[model samples]
Target: MNTDFQHGAMGPRPPDEDAIMVLLVDDQLMIGEALRRILASQPSIGFHYCSDPNTALKVAAEVRPTVILQDLVMPGVNGLDLVRQYRQSPATRDIPVIVLSTKEEAAVKSEAFAVGANDYLVKLPDRLELIARVRYHSRAYLNQLQRDEAYAALRESQRHLMAANLELQRLTKVDGLTGLSNRRYFDEYLAAEWARAAREGSPIAVMMIDVDEFKRYNDHYGHLAGDEVLKTVAEAIQAHCRQSSDLAARFGGEEFVMVLADATPGRTEELGTGLCRSIERLRVPHLASRVAGHVTISVGGALAVPEADTSPIRLVDAADKALYQSKAAGRNRATMMPEGVA
Candidate 1:
């Protein structure tokens, strides 16, 4: 509530680039004012004053003064007690405290030092010596503060770098066009899934999808338009392929691949049918498609419980044969491979 204590006398103006602050604490109004005036004469130091120990503690957290000049004896809370309190607080613990007292006895000085005083000086002592000591400690305090700030900044930068690296890793595995797994990622995932299915004796289904008359559609519409169509179809197929075990990828050009782990023949068929219906609902106009309507796709699926000796190439061949059947039956359909084909 006391503005005089809250806002101390202005010191010699610091340069625009750099300024050091000092806090002067004393219960006596005259002593606080005199200290502020004296410190203000120093060009590098900015002075703050507090008559109450409580106010000084609060200001220590807010202003973060470099060097604290505290009178050892006071009416209520003495400087030694203030020094102890400041040293205990995490916020102001590092700040250097110089105890100012009229008591010049060694016992008084020892007691002040034991209470966490960094330095001790008698009241109204040698002005030049006092100013020299204040300057020395203030510079040291500022240097320490700068080091702490730099460390905090470095830690923050490391956190940001880690987050960015994680995002980059995620982007690498994801397809840019449809937000599905890319071909490279799908290849790795499929191989892992196949190995797991073989180990667990679970059925896995592989489907190869081809957009009917895709080359003709690309010839009719420019490559950009073909890309847009491909993206749309990919989205449709991905929508129908739901489940944590389901994997989809753009398999180059207008062809795509899907893997369904732990699926039965019936489940594979149902999923294939659902995907066919989803593409039909898209209503993407493909005038050049071989089918009766607009854009359409042919899906060939092969379901098998892989063995330890089974090769990846054999599974792909089975799926490719079913895709051929879908093309032969007429585009825009799903076909399953014969059990003994591979």
Candidate 2:
């Protein structure tokens, strides 16, 4: 074997900003070292030399070499075998492999290409041709690398934007003070529920609750204390609305609303009465009210099977009328709306 390798010539010069990594695999230690020194002298090429095909594969994975320079005749694993191995491994499959060999036969060249060799170069080729081949492949590899990085970055940004949009939607519909759905969300939900109830011929119930003597309590205890009372009362109401279809909301100052899906008139009244009793039991000391010794709530309930002719506002108004009746008849009591009205 004529292994009289040319060792002195420097490889292709690398770009100052970005250099292409190249892997040189050969069984002869002198041949591998010569190739490494030649390529290392080039400013634009980053060369990794391996005497074993397995070690070359390992280095290819770690460095992601842009170009592979393989020697065909080796003792253990030949250059053609190494090319097959590189092509089989997903990590190294796309790397371009050029076979450097002493055998210049056309049959040897054909076998090299059959095993996935990208280019075939005879040993001791002209230095200028070697440099040109390396430079062309390096530029192509750099282009692909840039494109892949840009695509990855774009996908990451899209994911972040989607997450931020979802967070914004959550904040918009959620009440800051009580962590329940706000009035805006409640209105939208009521409309949808009304439509569903009409289609299913199921009863939908509305409950309007007013904190007894809330205005007087705010005046006597200050707004901060009133806020605390409101939060506590909101929690109490939410506790009573345990079902997935039940919705509780703060319907403006000292007043709250609940929607009970598929509830009967009697069931609505029972739930409303229970909620009123729970608030009364809270006994948040409010000495200013004549109706009760402590803080309490009056509830007005209405239940109806929704129809195409019925609107969400009608249900609210009916509940409001019943609530007014409760306040007038005497505070701290629950009243049910008349059947025809709701």
Candidate 2 wrong stretches, greater than 4 Å: 1-161
* Model 1 Cα lDDT, one tens digit per residue, 1-342: 333343432443211223566777877788877776676677666777877776778877776676788888777676788899999998778878999888688998999889888998888657687778877787786667556765467557767999999999989988887777888898898889889988998888888898888888889887888888888988887876779888888887778989888877888888777777778887888887768557888999898888886766677789888999889998789988765354
Instruction: Give lDDT tens digits, candidate 2, residues 1-342.
Output: 222222222233222226676777777777766666666567766766666665767766766667888888877676788899999998778778889988689999999999898889997656677777877776776566556765367557767999999999999987888777799999999999999999998889899999999999989899999999999999999999878999999888888999999887778888888998999888899988888879989999888888885797889999998999999989788999866578
Query: How accurate locally, in lDDT, is each candidate?
Result: 0.78, 0.81
Cα TM-score of candidate 1: 0.56
Q: What is the lDDT of candidate 1?
A: 0.78
lDDT of 2 at 151: 39
Which residue pairs collide in model 1, if any?
11-40
